[model samples]
Target chain A: MNEYLENAKAQMRKGVLEYCILSVLSEGDAYVSDIIRRLKEAQMIVVEGTLYPLLMRQKNAGWLAYRWEESTQGPPRKYYAITDAGRQLLAELDTAWQDLGDSVIKIRQPEKTHSHEKRI
Target chain B: MKNVFNICINGIIFGIEEDAFKPLSDYLEPLKAYFSREKDGSEIVADIEARIAELFTERPGGAATAITIADVNAIISTLGTPAAIAGVDESANTEAQPCAPRRTARRLFRNPAERYISGVCGGIATWFGMSPAILRIALIVATFFIHWLPILYLVLWAVIPLAKTTAQKLEMYGKEVNITNIEQSVKDNSLDTGSPVQTFFRDVDSALGRFCRILLRIVVLVIGLKLIVAGLMLLVAFIVWTCLQDVLFRDVVKWDFLAYEEMLRHIISASSYQIFMICSVVFILLTVAACLFWGAQLIRPFKTGNRMTHILLAALWAGSAMGIVGISLREMRHFTNPNSMSETFTVPVTDTLHLQTVSANMKLSNNAVTGLYFDKSQQRFFGEPTLNICHSRNGQALLEIRRRALGRSKPDAFDKLAGIGYQVAINDTLLQLPDLFSVSPPDRWSFQEVHLFLYLPENTIVAMDEGVMAHMHSNAHSRTGQQEYLWRVTDKGPRKIK
Candidate 1:
């Protein structure tokens, strides 16, 4: 039962992880480790394995592109950048996420109906 | 260690242990399988492997000589397990245990508030749920047994973080760092203020502690540097001396139990000499290595094997010493009996009997032989026969030549002494002697010596050539002059001829 809740939470977070990755890449290009570090700093991702497939899928869908950058310390790193399609996708996901957040807040906190009514 | 396999991941090459390579390869297989459905799956796996290689290079030690199974396991932990990478738990992999919930493990943190020598023991005791006093007693006992235990403790004290914050102190003792605990700790600290006297003593104690620590560090640095230099010079000297002995005197020095190698071999076991040499060499090497190790450790602490290593080294050193002593005693047995060989020749008493040396051309063998030179004259080697003029026992004028050697028995020593080849020719008044004594090739060089005793009558005179004066016996009263002086023996001992 606990495992099911964890899987459900993981799935919920997985959806927005893509939106977050696109939003980060929209600003500038980043190495794969740099992206993982940024996501970790925000407490949005758990493992590095989750990012590779997501980045590959985004690239396959023509929303992201990556190039190899040589590193002085060790192996060359894969740097990812957002294509125009990824920016468009990020814009659409931002609006949808804000709407879902507001609806969830309204449903969960019925005592805030007065504030909700005033805002509407 | 087992042989390592050379592997190339991406463009970099690494030598990995045979056992670690299998698990690491197996781990990558699953990663490949997980990404197989994607178009660029192999590329992703390659990139990950390259990253794994990079991380492996950054392990505590610089390069992986033989990557152990532990190294592979550590890499897996850092990169996540195969099951986590695949996101699908396969029942086939028994190692796919779910990652445990990340709980704060009690970290070792020195508590300055309760410190006695960095509070490392206190921190360790708290972490292990033991009383600090018991741990301190145990550590003291271990330090006595293990010579480097104190240094190891100091290194840990330098490395482990201090528990400065309340949360860290709570973690050190495995206490829950919640709001209640924090509030209670704050309240306790505010209420329990030490007396002014206690506070003053504490401040003085910490100040003294800091001063001692700095002083110890400076002393260690200076002494360590000095010892390191001394150790290096000793090592170099040892190397040079050993090399010279091994190379330069390989055939010259008869490495036998006694003087004559062949004779000793026939009399006693030859292996004892070899054992003695080996034992001495091992003892020297172990002592030198210990010195170098200690000096290096003082300069910079390193993780060395525990007490067992020291015990084993000490045992080996003792064993070598015993081996040397046993073999040396065995060798000394060959010299128990002494013997001498003497030849006497009658000579007519003259006013003066001059002692002169034969030319060097006659002394040098057709084949070149190298040995220690006894004087400025390169022609005379240490084993070369020495001529010492002494008074003969009888009142009659005569010359006696005695050669000496040692052996296990009387006859053996006499036979060995007889092998010394020394010759003197009487030409008119001049006694011509070979510049160097020759020991037969078959005879071993036992401290063999040649003594030439020329007996003089009460009124007879004697003179020595400058060439043989260097080999004169201490009692021979030969006066030194620009031209060698002759000495006349009257009733009142020998007097210089004016």
Candidate 2:
């Protein structure tokens, strides 16, 4: 049961990881480290290395664009920003998220189902 | 202390401990392979490397301190496994089982970490899954029977590549190439926990390595100490020899009457002699400095200014050596063409001709110096001339004085030969020849030599003095301690008339 829960949690995180990254960049441009930091703060991702492929995949799909920014401490930083298509997709994802949350909440309310049956 | 290697990652350089590099490289290699199927995969790897570089730079000591294995482990944990990085659902912990030993074909590679010499025997042992000690012993035992085994081992040592990387090390033991195996091999510090004999050999190998390292250090220290002592002694000896040339050469040693400078001046031109002395002194000083520097380095290793100092020293040494060689070549020209001048003095026709040698009779403690001597009153260098006897064709008695010397040219040789001084006093039938001949100053030595040839009629009886025995040629042999010996000049040359 614990393995099943872990699998489900991993699957859920993997599904929404791209959405969370886009949402973070939709607010403003951020380099990879900053994005990783914010995502880690939100508990959206565990490892920083996991974010690179997702970012690359999103950029290849035209939802994210990146630019090289000079870094003071090390090599140049790759700053990612959401594109117009990414913003449009985030709006659609926002509605989908709300609808899914409502469905889940409605499915969770057994008391409402019992009260409806009592009224019947 | 662990060895540190300078590694460049994403254009930033860092010093990393030798053991830490294996894990770090193993983590990246699998990640690279996992991502290679995607477009811009190399770009993703580059980004990850850049991040790693940034993380390394962000450490407390920055890039100045060596990156240890703990630092590498922390980075690896932060980066997660390659599968997780590739968005795979599988957890790293679930897949952490040790790789099963597979019977794959193994490639031969020199196992440098477990080697006694070039790791050939260890490599062969690993190939056949046996203890390296067995193979090493076998090779040693076989070497006595087959002399060519060592040559073959050297050939194999040159041909085989070292198992430097984790993958090659795994391949050497025929382990399957997978993420688990690579990680295991990297983290496996205690490698090859095999049979008891193998473990024993492994323990012995490490112990021997430690022993050899200590022995090498002790050897270096001993050599350094010896060099320091030898260099200091040589320096002191050089100084003493240079400063007290007269006391060392004349009084205390009585080896040579001429001083060091005087002896050098006799062999080379005055200008070249000065240059030679300067060059010799500089060379000795530079050599001593080099010896001291290297000795100190060996005893207590420390960094100096830069490679420039070493280069400067080597340059000075080579320059001095070249100067010495150039002066020697220039001086060699003086002793090239040899010329001889002969002077003949006719002797009275007599059946009995007395020959005697007049000793220089200089006041001395003892006759320690041979062949060459110094005349105190004349202040000249004199050498003993050789005496030879032969029959004359004219049936007349004659004494011939042949002075030979070398110079740059034939005329120069003749001019140098003119410097040779020899005198023979003829009184009635007795000829008194000085045992020593003198070479005048300003001409240098140039291999000056003198030979006296006594030409006499057949059956002429000749008597030689005891002092002339040392100067006699090998053709004329006489027993020592004898006052005199009679020699008859016959048609068949001089025969000793006992």
The number of the candidate with the highest lDDT is 2
User: What does the lDDT read for residue B447 in candidate 1?
Assistant: 52
> How many clashing residue pairs appear in each of the predictions shown?
2, 0
Tens-digit lDDT track for model 1 on B1-498?
A: 587998877776778988888788766654664455457877767767766777677777745555688988887876766555555222223224344332467777775655667888767766776555556667767988899999989898989898766566657756544433344555455212311234555565567567767889889978878777777787776775655544655467443111222233333455775676678778878877777787788889999989998999999999999997887687777777788878998777677788787755532222123222222223222355555444444678777888887777898787767777777898778888776665543324455667777677776777767666656554554545645756676765566667
lDDT by residue (tens digit), candidate 2, B435-485: 787687633566788998888899888887777766778555556778887
Candidate 1, residue B245: the lDDT equals 43
Q: What is the TM-score of chain B alone in each candidate?
A: 0.46, 0.67
Model 1 chain B TM at 0.46
Best by TM-score: 2
- Interface DockQ of candidate 2: 0.47
Cα RMSD (Å) between model 2 and the true structure?
A: 11.2
